[model samples]
Target: MTIVVAYADTPPGHAAVTAAVAESRGGEAVVIVPAVRDERVPDVAELEGRWPELAGRVEVERGDLGDPSDTVIQVSQRLDARLVVLGLRARTPVGKLVFGSTAQRILLDATCPVLAVKPSVAGP
Candidate 1:
């Protein structure tokens, strides 16, 4: 089965792709680019360039500029993916309450198992 990845162009997004590559273990990765404020999405060329190891097997799907949580959940269910991989960053309790989290929604709603990972920190 293919592994579904929630991809973006930020640090967390890059981290998610890396984590997905490691988890795929030579399997295919269905990368979904959830819409951002700018409407910029990552094409195959970008994804391949950023992740050479997963070049051929990476399939990118662009979502509409809407609720990211909905896109992720829908795609995961439709693909019947083995797992849904996403990058997670730490957030304060107040921040979470103020602005609802897409990651939290995905974790609670995805049909397949969700794998949330944080980027590794560099030593000072």
Candidate 2:
């Protein structure tokens, strides 16, 4: 089964990739990162450093797709993915009322199942 991860240079995106990889143990996990237009986004170094840990499980694709949420689902569809995974940031009621969450948008539009991962931590 093919699983797709939507990655941005954000904590949520990082966690999304991690969750994607974990769930894709016996499947293919593809990471989709948008290419910057004029300004560049930092490269995902973890993709290389963690190669040994991922090896055949992960594949990276770069594209300057116009719509991030749409692009993510499109890539998943193109790959015939069984799942599309993305991280979600908890938003306040006001925030959600003003602007919907990416995960919510994706969940509503994705053709396949979508996994919304939220980071849960304790202590400091």
What are the C-alpha RMSDs, in order, of all predicted structures?
1.8, 3.1
Clash count list over all predictions: 0, 0
Tell me the tens digit of each residue's lDDT in model 2 across 1-124.
Answer: 7878766656776677778777775646566454222323334465745534555556666544676676777778788888888877778999988975657768999999988887666579
Candidate 1 wrong stretches, greater than 4 Å: 35-39
- TM-score of model 2 relative to the true fold? 0.77
Please give, for residues 46-116, the per-residue lDDT of candidate 1 as tens digits.
77887788777888665553787778777777778899988888899999999988889889988888899
TM-score (all chains, Cα) for each model: 0.89, 0.77
Clashing pairs in 1: none
Off by over 4 Å in 2: 34-45
Question: TM-score of the candidate numbered 1?
Answer: 0.89
